[model samples]
Target: MVVSCGLLTANKERVPLKGIEVEVEVKDHVAVVVYTQHYENKEDKAIEAVFVFPLPGDAAVCHFSAKIGQTEIVAEVKEKQEAREEYDDALSSGQQAFLLEESDQSPDIFSLNVGSLPPGESASIRLEYVTELAVEADSGLRFCLPVVLNPRYQPQGSEGHGVKVTAVPASLVPYSLSFSARVSSPREVLKVDSKCSLEPLQYLNKEKTQAVVKLAAGHKFDRDIELFIYYKNAHQPAAVVEAGKAFATPGTIIGDPVMMLSVYPEFSQEVMSSITTSGEFVFLLDRSGSMDGARISSARDTLLLLLKSLPVGCYFNIYSFGSSFEPIFQNSIEYNETTLEKAQKKVEEMRADMGGTEILKPLNHIYSQPCIPGQPRQSAEGTDGHVTVTYTLAGHSFHDKLSFPLQPTEDTGLTVHRLGARTLIRCLETEKGEEVKKKVVEVSVQSGVSSSFTSFIAVNKTSREAIHGPLLQRRIPGVWSRSCYSLSQQAVVPMMLSHSMAKASRMQSHGMARACSMQSHAMAPAAMLQGNTLGVKAKPESLSVMDKVKHLFRPESKCSDDPVPTPAILKHPDSLLQLVSLQKASGCWELNPALAAALNKTSKELEQPKPPKVNGNVWATVLALVWLHAFKLDAQIEWKLLAQKAVSWLTAQNAPSMTECIMAGNTLLGSNVQKDALGL
Candidate 1:
């Protein structure tokens, strides 16, 4: 039977969450996050609460603990099976136990089972994890706290992991979140910006290396909380040493000071120019139901931009899929004007009506084809679910590295683990060939980085008396997937697609709904249809269901507040001033003698059309413009007035495509702005 925590309580209202408090501390490059959830059983009968949440894919969880009044229980890591058994035993005996485990499918999704709380009792759960902040394409360090866990599409023959997360409207969450972050680094912290409104950054130290930021009051939890942190001399490699716990014995993992190393590898200009200019690019699009709204539109825009940007002699094709798959062209073809036009037409006509999200089949088909010698193959996958499958595909691909298309608190672990020598050797042998085994082993030994598939567990043997009462289980809901469409119109589909999706959804819900070892509540297609299937809360101005569906597909503005959004660089004072300072009286930010030399080019070569590489003048201009767009900065003058000459000069140059200029800007700034939004 399916039990929903969202099911109305005895008073015909949702259960009230006591509170959610998040604390984050950053030391150098690593961030430790702690999430504490307080829950009270106000009802007369005993209750159990299950929370299905999300974390960054690379986060390394190290601690789990629970507290009841003054009694505290600290958990220990064991093998998956062993941990489950102990949790089940504790639950069956009526003693409170909490189980926190990683989902085998997606690294981001996790299920927390807070079991068997007696009537009027309150429990607080604290889970802590550590993760390295990833530097964005724009050189900013990005930190995100996921408020919604979007549903992931599952492939055929895949065993489901974690509880089936029903998508609920955010208003129904019955909880409020309070969060704060403390940041420290060797380099000076320049600024911090967030998608969510934030309180002003408060400096805690005179050196400007330490700061604190908090979420602004009245946040609605409708979207993910994202923070982009900029630092002075960001690319400079640095290391930080954190002293270990004092209570632990010295000379061990718990006692030794942990050092974090950050490195930014630099490549020579000569090496970049040598790479072949022509290659076969394959575009894989996901048209699954989960990809119903903004996701599909984003993919369409991405494809159009990519199609327009292909080199003169490159080859390309498009493959889109749902439950099954299809190819725009039976084989890879040249990316000429006619072919590009044909592919663009097909992409525009594409829809998210392909049934279910099945990616493996098309991937196998693409792999089955013979590769050309000079024309290296590249696959650009566009999807948001089944990330592990994508990882495995990229891991096995010979020519291409995965490019992420788009897109933590706590601490309890005061200890580190032995590098898991055995697991490292096994992973290296299985993933890489024997050729690099010795080198990998040497590095692992020296670096002391822990291996995958190993876990840390803590156990407390103190026991309490058992009480005889009924055991209840409930599945927690998560945020709807970015690709998800309203399920309220399930009956509108053709019978064949309907049947296929029903089967797929049933299988998916079964795998997702499982809480610990308990049976998961299955959601039938009919029931799902009748429910709020849009995966978001209903808005105040209710529109017809059909209108809601149409709104999902509506094209969104690139940037708000303007009919034609200016490039990001035009809005930032530092970047804008840098561009203004680089501009010549001739109305262009020309790569003159001095500027050409800085770019590894001579003034004569800069004027030459296609001088064995990208044109220096256009690139220089784009770089100036791009620099103007990055990060928040203080601007003392009106940039729009000074920007006219450079913009006009740049616009008058017809030699380089806007696509080319954007790509050049991206190369110079390390920013990954999508093609359609380049605003050139």
Candidate 2:
């Protein structure tokens, strides 16, 4: 029989759980889930049970309770410090007590302390939470119950209050979960989809506005439980109004109806481009250890999406932060193809091995950089420390200007609109002891409607009796993937080779022979050798259509050849050639960890293989300029000759568009660049 199991600790003791049952109810787009965990102690002595788990980042917990046979005890919400004191007191007094709270560091992680359970005793803990269903990329309502909790990297200078998740292989987790969901919406239910096995959805009404689905039997908590609910006309704007609790006093905030509005605004591409035609786009990434696993992967994927969608002629830079901050470029640079290729290569090699998430430093640096005229600066940050970072950014001067251009304005506009609306509400009130703007900002930041700030509390006031026993305090571990943590240890892929007059390897395949035969050696203006490794002599050959296409994109092809120089306004051709030589087959450069340490410098300090501590993407851009300087004036024959092919190849390429590379480089440099520009 499958059983719920806590993380495998260094001690090797496994806390076996009985079962997990979840009941969910939906009203329009909001879903309220009641998670019940059953635990039984088989050990000979009394024990404390701790369970670290993941919930939706925005989940608002409203109820917590523990049941012991005939007696039922409920928990009450109090100030964090006070709640901790109460929980500790009950545990010391040997009374059966339970405590639940969100992690101050990460919204997605939470820990439960089940204290004072005697030997052979069993108890049921139930937690109820409410959250708005997120809209998926396909316009469906996405509901996810996370079973896999990855380790979160704590940033330097952050309070070490983030949950410490113990990881194990997925196959070793012994938890059995049974989940059933009821979905209700104003629109007719169209369908439901899930990665997990699910029973066919059942409609509750003929109108098809409501439906229910259940996980198939014999399921384990191996991965997140995900469900997508599609509705008719999902793209249409919509709103839902929920009445306040009946017990709440009338005319108060709790008594008022909670109104949620959704809007999808569209603007012409031209208008959108005109507003952000050229500007600085800064990306701040958190490579702290906690970002290991799916979090980093998701961040990388989001970075790629944003890079591809950038306007053709914008300047951008990346900063990643852990214990410190590093910027890819000392300042933002213009985007183009060759630079983009290098950036993409660097980004693809990023790992969440950076020590901590000290993000403020990078933010300060990014802000300190002088803004260019007619080019606005937009910063986006991505991290698991949502609350801490959001609170920090909310207080920044640039917070108002930082925004997602591609996202619907209403999403952002509403937050500002609501801030204004709340300001109006305060102005309407007779009380004016507090500064009006300050009060409004506080209300907007600390709204009860925000699950981030407030929590639900239920107390069993009827029970006055206390029990006697020694309550064992246990710290429960979440399910972490062992394989993900070791991703940094994987071997790096090797770079492909391309050079002038290089002898082709024995043609095991016809494709290689064709490629070699098509090289256009006769087009070279001179045979110059920078080094034995750089010079290549070859027979003249006809270039095929494919060969020309390959020649245009491949920088390595022109390594030793010098073509006729043309007047160019762009920097040293040799340095540019060296940078091109560093590109891997994936079109990006990566840090050689060994090389960095051998040079007695931190990876961030090393920056590039050449001069000026600019990281990979920036290194490539600087080298391009170095080459451009040679061709800018025809007076320098040797420099121009060497750089001519390099410059031509560089010009033919489009603007750098690989955001992931910028992100990776920034991360390596300990800089803060947000991923929110893509609304990720």
Candidate 3:
């Protein structure tokens, strides 16, 4: 019998014995799928599981299925090498029957064809796989294997999902990244070396369906290597196909939608060039709390690699953010081996401290600077007449953490104390109170969500660039989506703000509305500074449209469902639950582990001997209802009933606070969800 089995680690995350972690995010026309570390554990033990990938194709829907495969090896052990006996034994059992097939699986997800192949001699098979996005330029992109197995077994009791990275042992760090792996092209075998160099040019024979992998033993048992396959780079080809698919839409609709863009002779190339160049000429850095372990180490390593790759005189800068702001070296710098090597040392010493986020301050610092105009700065080891001009571009900022300010860093210990004292210095301003602009990023990886927030202090005087690309583009993308872009933009905001402040004060102190209207596609600070009035100095744009739209047209949001059906609610329960225990485990002094768990449990207990299975979709329903309110879903239902039912269950749990209890209580109505408890 084929029974469901999976590997579970601490915290209940899953690791399928032999499979890849895949993430899927559905969008309007396309799905942004992320494939992660290919599972590389195999001892020839038999495995049978089914995988299904639903590739939304142009002509029609196409399905790719991967199956379990098995192959046996036969080694002759004869001391006496008699030609006649050797020939007989070799002829009798040279070939072992190889079987490969898929077991049951979800219809939407697919597994590639896994083949049963013996070592040395490779066999050809007609196998199909999903074509995924190209993550790297390395030749390992297009991987083909005779057999494909679903990686990370469905998280035991949980739904099938990608392998959770943080759950794996450190030793099993994914050497390669996997994201949105789909196979439109057919090939066989996975490839990548444990160490450095891979086989030379033309390693892949166009005619051969599979390639033989040879490995020399290192730390593991035998001199063997694991095989992994990925889609090779065919960017130009993929673009053509995608374009064709896009064009095939009704000519009228297509024409109307992209008429202006189509007129640009080189729009596609220009767009692609921008994506590539944005980073080619960037200074992605990080200023989060934990810089210990490999956080700072990994970041330094990446910066070194990035700097070393820059073309001569390519511009860059180095700004550090925390409770206080300063530049490692003030201004946007030019690239050179000498400066690169020197900067590498500075980056390595980065550490974590309990400080507020001044993400916007740093970017503003760079924007405000009077550089060597376009002249590149000399190396950090300057022995010349020019004094190194590192500045303390300090600014006062607000933070939620200020309700309980942390002991300042040695560098900023006195500065924060001074600022706190300054707040009370002016009686009129003290009554005004500080305005807090918290920048947030919501990251959803697999089924989990994580959020990071940084405050933009209203005091107006700091500039520090606070984020960076430490991991590979493919790695930590979830974090990137949630936090990266916002932080990057936030970083730029201060630079633009400060530069505008200088420029406007110098020329004409045009008011804030006009300054805020400065518009640009790409955020090049120098370019943005030229016309910074509209965005920062202009009169406020009509808030009327947004106000009217919100009032008149309310569409049901993505997350919430309407009020729960009467059937889903119950009157009483045997015992109520409270995650006070779970809350304590999280190591925070003040927190509510969310009352949903307790309420869900109580709902089950209320059903008593025959408890109802709370529909997982109901969580989605609750989310939808909350979104509906956000989206202004105007459909009417008895809001009171939902609040009461949910609250009844929530109250039974006896939450620590009314806030927590009310938040949980609102779930039954699936309407009016509060802000704090929701996932980013």
Candidate 4:
């Protein structure tokens, strides 16, 4: 649970939002949260207060209501425009109304309107939402309550104004928050951890299947609250059946029981051992002004790590966008020593100098390029707000469906069904045609989940006596945490996006057409620009595709055997970066002085302990794997794919004395990493 600043009037007057009480229930992987906000108006006139906040992007908001004295009015879903009109009419008629709507641009943002609160009147607003928890790298279920409201940056001439927030220091916030959570699972609850202070967990039974925890008293409305819940045998399959509303209309989803099934499939060791060595990896980086401080720095570091980890013989390119876009190369170039060095240099020099976040043109440009035959396309996006990794298999599209074969409970709530309906509606949002939109609206209304076309509205109709007064409107400001940049990077997994191409014939036949259709979208003519939007002159000497291809394929007159020069920017690289930089494109590290330096050992010492029959490359690779497992387990998510590549390369070698090599490597590094841990 999380809470932040409350309501404010148009004149910057505080609306005396007393406190917030939040209760969370976690059953398996899904969480149901209810927030109750208490607002009191001490002003002489009636006022309307609007509060904007953030929620999990995929959350399903199923219930909203207002309690004023003895009356409780539950909200009903209606069309967005109709709800707005009804609320406005209620306010004009001197009746209290409440409206809650999702933001059009970002699914995570929401605005709640409390209309016509008379002088000396108090109101309690209840908002309940359900969301599935995300699995972290260590198998912990992550639930975050975001209280930070970083200012959103809108491109110049965009449709609506950006969210304006008046943030103060955490200590200066006026409101208090009370929060508690109940967690239950079929397996034992291993533990619960948070960055915020919390009371000791109380187990309800000896099996440790259920527990309750609460936030410590005197919590300031400040940083986002994050909870990581660990369970024994976290990947075990489970299912839950929830009954629908008792009085719901028959034949509808609300009238039927819904089943939520969770599955964790185990793949064969042979299939899991192999990783793709060929692909077209494109990285799109955001350089907007909002990304100025630690965000850009972290982006640069991440880019360096990725560039160092790319496989040999793959096609790669980088694009940076803001008010304008720039490409490192005219076309995608094959990965090699020269190309990798060039990209690394450019990445190190990149800055957040671009004016605005104009991503459409760059995306269009990327889509217009032809896909290389036999190379599946993958795109990774790095942005301050959201990080996305999209995998595009050439000719085939993959869809996942779940099956439930167990009996459903007879008495339960509709939360599970509502969440499922929200998921379906969002999936259909991008499809064309009025029929699709009609389907989305129908599902939204039936499940009581608000969508782009619908909103939740509650009005008090019992009181006919008009309380005449001026209605002042207020927009509550959300607080922005100072440590947002570091916190975001800490939680981010690596941006590696790769897909295996099981069929080369399919990739050659229909890959380009499928890739084009999937990537390209109809763009507004105004945004289809041939130059920068910030009045910067375009480069006149950009190379054509044919010229780039010719240059890429051209033979060098002379080849040098000298080692690749270490970038001056990384003169004193960290242990992790240094070891990563030494890895070859083929996913193996050469036995050299640089590798020894990265491992904090002398070259002579490394060679002295190597097995007599094994080659240097295998020994070096084994040592690197040992080091990674021993020291960087926390970053397993980011390095997992690369490590898989290394393992595949090692397996292909069929090196002798593998167990002896791993033991010697571990002993040399003073770490006890086993062969099985490195997939030997």
Predictions in order: lDDT: 0.51, 0.48, 0.26, 0.67
Where model 2 places Cα greater than 4 Å from the true spot, the runs are 1-16, 153-169, 245-255, 265-469, 473-477, 484-680
As for TM-score, the candidate ahead, 2 or 4, is 4
TM-score, per-candidate, Cα-based:
0.49, 0.49, 0.25, 0.61
Best lDDT goes to which candidate?
A: 4
**Could you arrange the candidates by TM-score from highest to lowest?**
4, 1, 2, 3
Per-residue lDDT of candidate 2, residues 269-378 (tens digit): 34432332355566666677755654465355434433433444566666666677676677777766655555555656667787865555765676577877756553
Across 279-329, the per-residue lDDT of candidate 4 in tens digits comes to 677777778775565456546655666666666677888888879999899
Candidate 4: list runs displaced more than 4 Å.
1-12, 153-160, 244-257, 266-405, 432-435, 464-469, 483-585, 589-635, 647-680
Is 1 or 2 the stronger prediction by lDDT? 1
Where does candidate 3 stray beyond 4 Å? 1-134, 138-233, 236-282, 311-315, 333-338, 354-358, 367-680
Superposed on all Cα atoms, the candidates' RMSDs to the truth, in angstroms, are 18.0, 20.1, 29.8, 13.5
Write candidate 1's Cα lDDT for 80-192 as tens digits.
55567787787776567777775654445677777777778788888877665545434577677777654343323444443555556766566778999999887899999
> Any idea what lDDT model 2 has?
0.48
Clashes of each: 26, 41, 93, 0
What's the lDDT for residue 7 in model 4? 45
